[model samples]
Target: MTKIFEMPLYPYTRTADQDAAAPVRHTAMIVGAGPVGLAAAIDLAEQGVPVVVLDDNDRVSFGSRAICFAKRQLEILDRLGCGQPMVDKGVVWNLGKVFFGDRRVYDFNLLPEEGHHRPAFINLQQYHLEDRLVARVRDLQRQGAEIELRGGNRVQAVDDLGDRVRLGIDTPEGPYTVETDWLIACDGAGSPIRSMLDLDFVGRVFEDNFLIADVVMEAEFPTERWFWFDPPFNPGQSALLHKQPDGVWRIDLQLGWDIDKEEEKTPERVIPRLRQMLGDEVAFELEWVSIYTFQCRRMERFRHNRVIFAGDSAHQVSPFGARGANSGIQDADNLAWKLGLVIQGRAPEGLLDSYDAERIAAADENILNSTRSTDFITPKSEISRLFRDAVLDLSEHYDFARPLVNSGRLSLPSVYDGSPLNADDALEGGPARTRPGAPCPDAPAGEGYLLDRLGGAFTILTLDAEAPERVSEAGIDAARVALSAGDDPTGALAERYLGAARSAIYLIRPDQHVAGRWPAYDEARIRAAIRRATGQE
Candidate 1:
């Protein structure tokens, strides 16, 4: 029998600072300990920045939420030292099948081409993920990462004073006031900080609701995503099936807005629907259940002076794409390096503004894709349904129409094209896959991967070339590595980074995004690009 996993609750201990005569200030304060806030804390602590993380709860998430972990999100988690465990414990699947009215319309594979480090996606319960992250923070704490997690502590007020932000925290022991150079709000969709400031979360709220249930059962279902538009068992609505770790299955049933939300969650009402989809012979135990409405919305900006918003606190999307947690992790990835640099005084505070512009663009992309997926899944009008059916029908035989079929376009990493931080590359003929402003494509580097070798600081990657004798110091931790033909035996690195016998040098940012690349190494250009990437130029 496969055993279910549960995380032990972290104890809420009163800190000396809470018992002090006056409120204690922290260098960085993070609100919430969900995946997003925890990611921020872990990333900052890994960079040796002291972080104080406050969470209103003392236990991991109760449900098997946010099951799909994208490859890019895994990479980000890998940097924080928790990705491998997730991959080890998760159910890895990249194939997805779409069906329409008992007819299989289309199927897709996420990782068609290879040489990447992580799989395209993994299915792990949100609780399990949070548990692993909490354990990782403990490990980092042992390593002298000054990170303090105060569970049962909630933020009641936030004041964005120039140069610093003040937070009024309410703890089980008592209430305390503290100030920080930066305050990152990773509280959920209902962000109290957002509410305190009266910031507008602008976007559309679709009139469709989805019922998600996690069931424990021994079944022969393949470990792949199966999506249905008007399934035969449950007509006029969509259904989704995904295999999660620990013999659990996540089922999503599209319930129109008019349905009674409370009554639908009861097992008496939900079991019959499950029996209709699965046979009565299949015995199962209910694990967790939730009903949620779709909303694709975001704040006007992610950053406000000394206070920054990340994760669901900044934007929200429908669950169809699995963009919420994945994008939230990316938000932490984008912010951590910039915040670390600013805190170290190596980069100007304007570097933090670039994080806002870039992540806001990512949020916009997520919202757009989620909105489109919602529209296709639950058409609002007869004409919309007609077009959706037509597209689904045509997708059965045609490849072009398959792209039109939106049963939730699975999450992918957003590229920061035309970002102010991206330096204009002089070399246009190199590999188009690793273009300027694109996340550095991972390739086989010595024993591990390119991303593992290049993150956490500015790195200059030279292919088929030697480092220039004279390198300029732009006041950032910069390292240079040259890969000779012998070092790259597979030629995969050259193919992904340098194309067609081309030799080049790439300036990779701390976040592992390409700042700029040149056909040949130029010391001055490299320094200038680094300065520009850091917002110093």
Candidate 2:
């Protein structure tokens, strides 16, 4: 079935902040109650913004939507005060093993990162994380902030008139209308939001399809991922094996282009193939199996007008690197605080436009990196397949060849370099090369209060030995400061982060990346940036 959409952009500020009073009397409406929408609503409510969140489903169910949460995603979840609980529930994995034809090809360990003590990655099902987030968001309601969750409510139409977004929702009660200052869509890959906007979701769809099955297996496959190359039963095809919680395992079997989708993917046929692809006597109980034909498309723009797109509504990557929902949540993290700032009369309207600039950069980078991963995983050309086999076959003997043989790429954080909203001197070379305003190094200070204790909105880390009152005088949130050097820049803190990075004040955005850094407190620049980042100026 084909979908058609039409979005109208009424005149609004294109490159400037509008003078306003009382924030134009706004409420926010969010479409889709998934992680991305929930995260966005949670961030907004915490900032004292009134929000109405709608979803077609009323409750949570465990399904395979997203599987991995990178370090960055965890940090954003921490802002909502739920990441620690998530960490407690899921196992942190710093080690990953790659195998080809029953032989180990490559292994990676990620503990050597500058600031983080925990592993860089965690393996938890998406719905489990969603379950945790929903609880955290509810906890905010006790403090007089509320998220009106309209379960079983589907957004049918959106009219983005410049000043307000008019929404038509179909609900169990009946059709209703919602008027909001902004509308955020988190409606997944086949987003009704995107379809209603008439925007092109442009990208190449992969010809090769894969059968994904979540099952319970008696075989004790190690926790690390296993990759098989050209198994005897499925010659010239590969499969992936990874374990999940509750003794379940996720298996991905490559489907040939010519194979009949329904006949070959049935439960009866999948078992024999599983036994052949994964050895006999495995005694694996099949749970759920589905065929996924992936595409590498991205929407032309994240925001068309009053309606803003997030998660699968913004972009869809070939699920090779597990960057889909995780990236979407980050987009919410970035956009929420800015929206709150604008709605609360803290920032100017121009700040909202930056949401488009920053997230588009994020989406573009995700697509490029995920595209590379897709190419590496599904070797399309004959030459690429031969080379992949050669590398895997040779990895055992050659010490230097091990890293080269790995099919996976180290997931690099998307950088916001070219964004006009980024500070001109934010990184400017030297030791701060992880993008202009990347997350600062995490260091442990033993007095029961560490850097980990300072998450929730933008964090201003004061590194000045003197405890300067400059930031406070400039009307910045000084109590929001995490005093890095209380008495002196102690060894405990210095050794954890790079020594030279001490004595610098870091202005971290709500997404936890450094928005700007200064050698000492500069009242004028920081105040301007705070206003800019929050849309206050």
Candidate 3:
């Protein structure tokens, strides 16, 4: 059967740069047309910056690699103009159940609150996500966005020329040279560009393997995450299950350190395991199968002058938390706006440093959480195993111990505490969740949502306060979004923005992160905050 991912979405085509007298330099060029690269391209294009994306392959990824997309990622996608389709095709869930052996430990709700438009998580195959991102690029192209996706364009060599990056690309036709003022590498974990630059990852790689299988079947399993520790089917090991868009079910079975990965991936060995997990009567077809070792590592720095790395090229985490692609998308979200500002001369080059600082912090947070989850899932020593088992046992009956059971501290948006771009919190008694350097929590605003109106540029959100229609500081304009408690019948706006203060104002970054907040609309303070957010202060 022919699937969307199997067809050539962006076939190789010759470009004028191949025959140019000199390499044509672009404002921004992204390597690898996967989710992160495509997202960065779309974001830069939307911000009026021209971008070109190059990929070695013309089709989407082969397997259902990353199946979990978090809510914050969905919000970023919404701002990128392709969130609805993803949500429509994804299987949404918030509840997750943890098990010890054959006994159920405890269940959890990731999104316990309301007012947010998206759910806690969505389970969709990576190919489907890439296909949608490609479609979005097409839509942007139709709308005259200066974005290009060149498939079959493999970068052979890279030269970092202080001010620009020179790349030797190998296409189906031949090789060509091109230049870019800025280069964004969104290549996979085993990044060729990283190797070309002689960069290496610094972190730990656990000595444990997990077999991932995407199986298609008609089953009655609920649409929720189910994780089993030391299950009878896979004794002394762990397993995970979740439903996908189609009848496909993603199953992960832990295999200890000493097993032959190739032998375990074979259908002869995999089919019997499936029969044991699901009764012998259940019929299913294997769609994709792979074995992966738990790795938690990242590059020392995401940016090296003109060439920058995003996505897996920057960092990697164990798949249990679904932080890989989600964090990579966040890398795109953080870099695009800063890069656009720098290219347009609206902000200084130092603004790009914030990307390094912010994303590195995010990457470290993910790696830390991922390492802890790996330790909990695959405890190294016998004492560690005993402690983990005792914690799991105690979690079944006690509510307090439930927090100790780490089935992967699920991915969440990183709060950039103490960021250089953040202005001092001036709003007295405001909610901590919406403080400077934190992603804005969505709330009901009129007919739509708060985030839908806050992104794409600097914004001054006035809650029961008066602000100007627009405020410009150092060539950056921040529009005003005025709303009152009456806008949201639920009073969530007031609760989130104005906890104890009667009126408040929030300065929002282009990526929907809060830059500053105040109790009144002071133009001088707003200008200072705008400058700080843009790295001009």
Candidate 4:
């Protein structure tokens, strides 16, 4: 394979023979058009950088894999302009019910005490989310964003050209080559890109297998998620049933005893188990049924050479908390700006180093969180099962275990200050130190904008009253960037929301995270921070 960068992208001159060559150069070439891959393409295009996305699948998927979206994921999608439509189509659950056998033990509301600024997480099928994202990417492509979608094309191999990257793509017509500035692989867990780079994924595979059944039922069930710790129908297994969009329900039956993987996936076995769990009174039509085993793995590194991994290509979680696509989208959001900046010559190529470090940190945390969740729910060993039962038994009386019972650790935003791109200890001073390198916290701003106004684009906020004018004098673009002055923010939000400080300036990334902020206003610091946030510096 030719090196990705040195290779010519577009045809300089056409050949007259039967075998001809056409070269078209792109700013970036992305592998896999799943939700994560397409999201990266759209984000890069939104930044005025040209992109080409290729996928082997000819159409969208019908079977739903991931069924929930966390608040942080929703915030990231909302910035991409897809959150509202998804929220409109998907069901939002504020509470979930956990059953200790036939008895209804407790009901938990996710964002119970937190105000309306941050509501509960959403439950939407992975397919619906992808469909909406695909539509948006198609629309963006139509607007001449240079985002090319070749659905039937597959990436055969990628070679780093030092200054650029080259790709050899296989299509039904024949083989074609694309040379681009950088390469991002959003392919799945068994990623060809990750394989080509020889990155080892380190983690464990759980022994338990889950029988997943997607069915459409006529009966009315609770809107909240219902999880049976150990139902009478399956003594050693867990049974769960949740409401999906348009009367569709998802039921999972833990296959306690081993069976032939091929023979058990049929609806005949899955239906019998469902009837056993819910009894004969529940009538339903099983739309799809499959067997799934959990795998918790993360690559030692997310980036190798010029080929960077996103989505499942970098890491995979047990889907206990719907962290699979959620983390992948987060990965795309983080890399989009950095890639654009490096491609546009606004920032050094070293900025791309953060893509691996920050995302890996997030992926590691997600794997740990999700794996812990799946393990706790589906304990493998007999002793572990006894401990789990003891914990659930203790929940009956112990008030101290309530926090453990209501563990919401998976829903929190990941911290990324550990990355090389983040210089929290730099000369920018204190206020910049406050933001760190994590998802920007949602604080209620004035007017109709509120928390919604802070995302989807670059923003500069001044709590000092004098910093706004000082930043404006630094030649910041006002059209795409919003300037806000928090002279006397509400006391309710003063300490917890926005900190009380002077001459403080915050530059928020497109992903709605505080990329960099400073307590003191310096022209070089402001421009550099804004450039770094927008992928310009």
Off by over 4 Å in 2: 1-26, 113-117, 399-406, 410-412, 424-430, 433-435, 447-451, 467-502, 535-537
- State the displacement of the C-alpha of residue 477, model 4, in Å, after optimal TM-score superposition: 5.8
Error of 4 at 208 (Å): 1.7
Pairs of residues clashing in candidate 2: 5-198, 346-536, 347-535, 347-536, 348-535, 348-536, 437-514
Give all candidates' CA lDDT scores. 0.88, 0.68, 0.94, 0.69
Tens-digit lDDT track of model 4 for 352-457: 7777777888887887887777878877789987877777777767766545652224456677775554433332334332455766655455643334766565
Regions of candidate 3 where Cα sits further than 4 Å from its true position? none
The regions of model 4 sitting more than 4 angstroms off are: 1-23, 114-118, 406-409, 423-434, 449-451, 469-495, 499-504, 516-537
Rank candidates by TM-score, best first.
Answer: 3, 1, 2, 4
| Cα displacement (Å) at residue 468, model 1 | 4.3
Candidate 4 local Cα displacement, residue 252, angstroms: 1.8
Q: What is the Å distance of residue 86 in model 1 from its true position?
A: 0.6
Higher-TM-score candidate among 1 and 3? 3
- Using lDDT, give the best candidate's number: 3
Output the lDDT of residue 187, model 2: 86
Better of 1 and 4 by TM-score: 1
Q: How would you encode candidate 3's per-residue C-alpha lDDT over 1-537 as one tens digit per residue?
A: 788778999999999999999999988999998899999999999998999999999999998999899999999999999999999999999999999999999999999988999999999999999999999999999999999999999999999999999999998788999999999999899899999999999999999999999999999999999999999999999999999988999999998999998999999999999888999989999999999999999999999998899999999999999999999999999999999999999999999999999999999999999999999999999999999999999999999899999999999999999899999799899999999999998999999999998878999899989889999889999999999988999988888889998999999999999999999988898999999899998
User: Over the stretch 215-256, how does candidate 1's per-residue lDDT look in tens digits?
Assistant: 999999999999999997789999999999888999999988
Sorted on lDDT, highest at the top, how do the candidates line up?
Answer: 3, 1, 4, 2
Q: Which pairs in model 1 have colliding backbones?
A: none
Error of 3 at 489 (Å): 2.1
